[model samples]
Target: MKSLTQGAHHIGLTVADLEKSAAFFTELLGWNEVARNEQYPAVFVSDGTVMLTLWAVKQEPSVAFDRKSNIGLHHVAIRVPEDSALDQIHQKLLAHGVEVEFAPEPLNGGPMRHMMCYEPSGIRLEFIWPGE
Candidate 1:
């Protein structure tokens, strides 16, 4: 059978604050808000290639994300163009008062370097750069 899936279209994440999460991605990743829905309480942002959808849940209580215990997403990793870009983002996230899990470092003693952090809504995000 022919492959039905082409590639990832978008990633939908549940956030406590729609505007805050939207702003975070826009500022950090340079994504632009392309669409929004008040009824669904979602904001869609894209970096001219991939789209990320942030869904707001005001009525429900927020639950902290636990990668080990949770059955869902562990983290979302985005690729950076260069090794220095990872550090650049790390600094910006710190300036924005965003929580940084750790500074950028070599991944598993390999050429790849990565840094992990949490978005405003408590979702773990990773920025990685694979060495040349």
Candidate 2:
């Protein structure tokens, strides 16, 4: 037997603020708004290779995602082009006032490095740099 499915088409994330989330991708991450659905109140963003659908929460007082207890997405790991890019982006995140869980450091002991942070809408994101 063989695997029948292809890779991910797109990832959907529920956000507290639609506009803020969209801005995070466009302004901060340099992604483009590819499409929008008014009825669903969602924004589709792409960085040329990957697409993510940001959905607005329909209700107020929504609960935040807890990686320890919740059974959903832990974090979205985005790959950077080079090792130094990780530090560059980390500085950008700080200047933009994004909440960083930690600064860029070794992934385990050697090669790859990574950092953790939360976007404006509280979505956990991990940026990684695979060493050459």
Candidate 3:
């Protein structure tokens, strides 16, 4: 096996609305698609260093809310550039008719902002700044 120091790379998740979901990440997070394989039903997006991939899965929106059976996947938190960016994200989410997971707040539990939503298949997603 490769050494543990090799480090981790990307995280992949299957989503219902591939284009819309990809837009949600790229447009909101400032990522761009660099690679794709339709046969795999997935595409990779990156910002020079970090890479994110979303797999296309055909499913209904209700899937995002139910997890009692498998608890399949919880939530994915993508770190944004700053603490202030979340406010802008929240507004955008509203414009798009998405709900907030809990109101946005500071990482230290103070008052700030963050973007939180469930994808078309009910998988959890988040956008926030990394801890101080």
**Among all candidates shown, the one with the greatest TM-score:** 2
Candidate 2 colliding pairs: none
> Which residue pairs does candidate 3 place in steric collision?
64-121, 64-122
Question: Which of 2 and 3 is ahead in TM-score?
Answer: 2
- How much does candidate 1 score in TM-score? 0.92
lDDT of 3 by residue, 1-132 (tens): 877675438878877777877887677657789888888788788866667788887555434445566655557676777776777777777777776675577655654346577655457777777644
Poorest 10 consecutive residues by lDDT, candidate 2 = 105-114
lDDT (tens digit, per residue) of candidate 2 on 2-22:
999987888999999999999
Error of 2 at 10 (Å): 0.7
Model 1 gets an lDDT of 0.90
Per-model TM-score, in order, reads 0.92, 0.94, 0.74
Number of clashes in every candidate structure?
Answer: 0, 0, 2
Off by over 4 Å in 1: 1-3
- Give the per-residue lDDT of model 1 (tens digit) for 1-132: 999998789999999888999999897778899999999989999878778999997676677778998799999988888999999999999999999999999998968999999999889999999886
